[model samples]
Target: MTIASTLRLSLYGVALSAISTLGLIGCSNSSTDTAATTENSSAADAEKPAKSIAITQIVEHPSLDDMRRGIIDELADNGYVEGQNLTVNFQSAQGNTATAGQIAKQFAGDNPDAIVAISTPSAQSIVAATTTIPIIYTAVSDPLGAKLINEDGKPFQSNLTGLSSQLPLEPQLDLLQQIKPEMKTIGYVYSPGEANSVSLRDSLKQALPARDLTLLDIPANRPTDIGMATRSLQGRADIIYTSFDNNVASAFEAMTQAANELKLPIVASDEFSVKRGAAAALGVNDYDFGRTTGKMVYRVLNGEAINNIEPAVMNDLTLYISPKHAKTQGVSLPAELLKNGINVDEQAQSTDNK
Candidate 1:
């Protein structure tokens, strides 16, 4: 039509192109700013990493629950106070291994500042879930047998370190003898799925025979089946012994009930078990074991490399007798043993309040 109209159309086209260019430039700037902000946020989180911890346990037993409390208390003593400066996330597998694995995967994805695994199953799950995030485990016996550590005595992952609950065997055996002076066979109820229990069972097999005592280990595949397993040991064993097996500990009350029906006394490996119903327990203080684990976690969070901190074992053992529980289990704790050991029913009330 008209040259002037064509010129106007060209100008409009040019203006549209210019506006589009400006819009593209603004979008680019916005994207760059967002990326930079994200990077800065991540770096800030890295700098203040002692603020969060994710914890998981295979079961909700007194020993493991106490250990978790000990971990938090230890961290608080070192300045990472929960609800003030620290955030703690905890999950319990409730004696299910599949749940343990699911919790481990969640913790790995959440990428917390640190992870605390309370039992062998939970520890194995988390150790398999991630290799970069720092992990500190506690209440595990036979770390090597659990495959958390290699034969070289080093953690399998550079990011892994922990505390072992392995206690001296002599004290445990002595307590058993005190409970049953003429004991010929020591019956043990354990979880075959747990590495710690298997390790302890093997050790007892060798250690007991040296003292002319034999071990009768019955496997309870599930927590609910523990009482039935205990009843199975009726004619075979003189007294029942239990280690730090997560499954057995979770259902200890049931086992004690069955044992009471059979007039069988139970000798447990930890003090918390004594509180539940075991006639006596001689093992490491689970809370102290957990506090020591917190120290390792604190070191890792405080910028210490995890590989530099080796896995440790707490060996200090204490005897705890529940005469009330003993009476129910048809065993009388020796007078000398009662004088030497802590009465869990009386003295443990103070410790439990903490």
Candidate 2:
């Protein structure tokens, strides 16, 4: 063996060993950095607490149902998705006020970020349940009467704020008058048990006389009574008018059935009622009201004080008319109304069937 060749072979082996050592060190440093990054990311995610909210509704009618769905959708759009960073718990009272009270108690105990009350009854119940948990209410016709807010629609102390479904009486009455210019008597079917309905009924008494229209008040104590109360208006009331009374809304189909049989047209304060055989509806979309309520909730969950957020009312009025329904109820909508209003041509199904 030659000495020079032996030396060359030994140097090559040493060089190879040095390269392998550097490669191993580079791999160790890369792995450590990647693992640290992953750990820090996990810790950050863990630090973010999961937010939750509870929602309650007086009944499961289409208006309230759409409101609830809109709230959920609004939250989802704002990144507080259900089954993710936010937890949404919803319950319906099934048209029972007592059951509403019970559900409010349950939700109050849970102590979520906010409680969304759909109707006046549920709003009153939840407000009674907790003074601390933020209460965001919607579909309430009169927040003042419900005591959810004080003067000028500001939160009445405690954790309370909401959007009101207070009907724009002038526009609604105008729609009815347009439908029947000779409507001397307007019959209303409402539930006295609900504070909003009673508020609306009282308001009607004052507003109708100014317009030269007399109001025939038909008070329905229960869902079953809605049909009978409506039938009683026959031969007296020139047309049937309905507000967003939970009980009356629960059996709205029955009332519409009797109205149709009596050949009486209906003017409603809920957009959903047009789909339930009302001749026309002039009111705010409850779903939009729910979404607005959700925005209020988002502000609350983000740490804004409840009272700091002033209560809002549904402003934009949408008119809906069903030609088929109007004809069935012995009235024909005006040509301008057919052109201006949202024309719903689909046949109306009963509340029970829907």
User: What lDDT tens digits, residue by residue, belong to model 2 across residues 85-191?
Assistant: 78989899998999999999999899999999999999999988998998988888888898888776567756887777666677677778888889899999888
Displacement of residue 147 (Cα, Å) in model 1 is 1.0
List model 1 lDDT by residue over 148-242, tens digit each: 99888689889998887666566677777878889899998889899888998899988987899999888889999999999999888999988
User: Which residue segments of model 1 deviate by more than 4 Å?
Assistant: 1-50, 348-354
lDDT per model vs. reference: 0.79, 0.79
What is the total number of backbone clashes in candidate 1? 0
Worst 10 residues of 2 by lDDT: 22-31
Q: Per model, how many backbone clashes are there?
A: 0, 0
Listed in order, each prediction's TM-score against the native is: 0.83, 0.83
Please give the RMSD of candidate 2 to the true structure: 21.6
- Quote the RMSD, in angstroms, for model 1: 22.4
Model 1 worst lDDT window (10 residues): 3-12
- Model 2 local distance difference test score: 0.79
Each model's Cα RMSD: 22.4, 21.6
